[model samples]
Target: DPKVDVLGLPDWVKFIFLDIGLASIVFTCILGQLTTQVNASHMMIDFINNYFAVFTLYTAMTIEFIGIMHCAYLIKNILSAVSGKPILSNEPPKTGFTFAFYWVRVLMSCAILSFCVAVVFTALLAGDTAVSVKYPSISPPLAVVLLLFFMGVVGTLEAMQIAFFSVAKLPPSQRGTNWFGSKTCSLLFDGNGKNLPTFMIGRQLTVVCSFFLVGSFTSLTIVPGTGNNIFGVSDTSQAFLNYGFQGAVMTTILASIMWQYAASAFPVTFLNSLISFILLIVALCLEGTGICGACWV
Candidate 1:
């Protein structure tokens, strides 16, 4: 009885239960969206069908990503502690740096999940890449570039999110009293008064890259979309709407990943980023090859 916590559940058992319950609820709603048909003509149904569905799918994917990443990190930390690893070793883990990856992981996850939803919708509603297009086709080089661009866009956004979070996480007492000095320094670095800046240079570069990306056509939305355009002025608007939902999902994922990996090492961050990068690359290749199948436009 003394060993058991509230509700007679061990801490680990409670965590497992929590994970399972959360995952089940998210997936069940996703299933509902996939199965239940709604009229596109009615206002509510139209919004649900066109807007809400995409939002729900991406949100679910983001939640799944965060949960999975957190569990993996928690397990690693438990193993390390059980193995009698020293926490305050000379090469101490830069937790702040690793935590920054929380933002990166969430953004990347959303990009991936949203991309999948787009493909699935295309396949079900229209046709896929089974048919060859002769008039205007994407060259292999161009396709690779497009895929890289997508990753870059996501990466830049990730960098910005990290910057914002890092600054926000700083204690008020740690911040500079002068507005001009605080604003100027905050624009460059991401850290409290204690540790050196983490990802400051990276953030600066990313902010510039993201600026160019925002101005360019490399984003999810395009001026003239190829869908029925019934959801909004164009299908691109719906894509943007899905993106908005993914932003909320990203916020939750960032918090979850950081809390779970609070005691984790740099290796955890590296491995997560590597996996996310690889997945994006594979997905891009699939897109290029037409193996994953394209949506009917």
Candidate 2:
């Protein structure tokens, strides 16, 4: 999105996905080495299962961070719009500006962030606290539940707040093209009669489902991992293999994200970040399942 072309971003930030990919490479190697050193003759199976497990579990965080950055593109556009401004050339906003002028914008952004964190944390703590009584360990299932709770509560609110506020503040002329677009924004911000809760529930369900699908795929790999397999790849190899897939996913996902950013900038950018993100999701699922099947059956 034209919004994504912020000029001031360090080259490193722009290429973070590759960096993440490289880190996964290093992580895989280290994990494999550690497994070999520890398990000696019997390490292969353990390594395979563990390798996949690490990447699968870590995927949650990885996807989430990328998604959040993905959100930044929309945010920048909506934000610059709010300021009655348009980015001249994807240049990064000047730094060292007197906070006195931009504090409201800065504060608004920070408050939204704080609320997102607080709500997610509270929901997680609540779920963990609640689940502990029945399920002792922090199992994968419980983790998913916690994540669902986070998204269901915090994710919707975060999206709503940004979407509405941005949509609301803009002139009717620019507030999305739809006749109802501005109306919807006003409704969202006004906390319309029970509409907010209903919309929130829908959004919550959607996000929770997204997590569940990903979690289900990840669980297939990890849950079986605790079991024994004679010829299963060691956890280390599994992690590296999984890491390789994740690295690939991140690379594609990153490209998609950057494309999405560029697309947001002017009008037409022949790219979509979501395409690769979706592909990455599928690749991880296939690779994760492959490892599981290889070892389990």
Each prediction's TM-score versus the true structure: 0.25, 0.27
lDDT string, candidate 2, 75-132, tens digits: 5666467555576677556467543434444454445444444433343344422233
CA RMSD (A), model 2: 23.9
Shift of residue 250 alpha carbon in model 2, Å: 4.7
lDDT score of model 2? 0.39
Q: Give candidates' CA RMSD values in order.
A: 23.4, 23.9
Global fold similarity of model 2 (TM-score): 0.27
Per-residue lDDT of candidate 1, residues 146-236 (tens digit): 4345445444334333433444445644433444435433433435421122222222233333333322222223233665432344565
Candidate 1 matches the true fold with a TM-score of 0.25
Every candidate's lDDT: 0.39, 0.39
For model 2 the local lDDT of residue 242 reads: 34
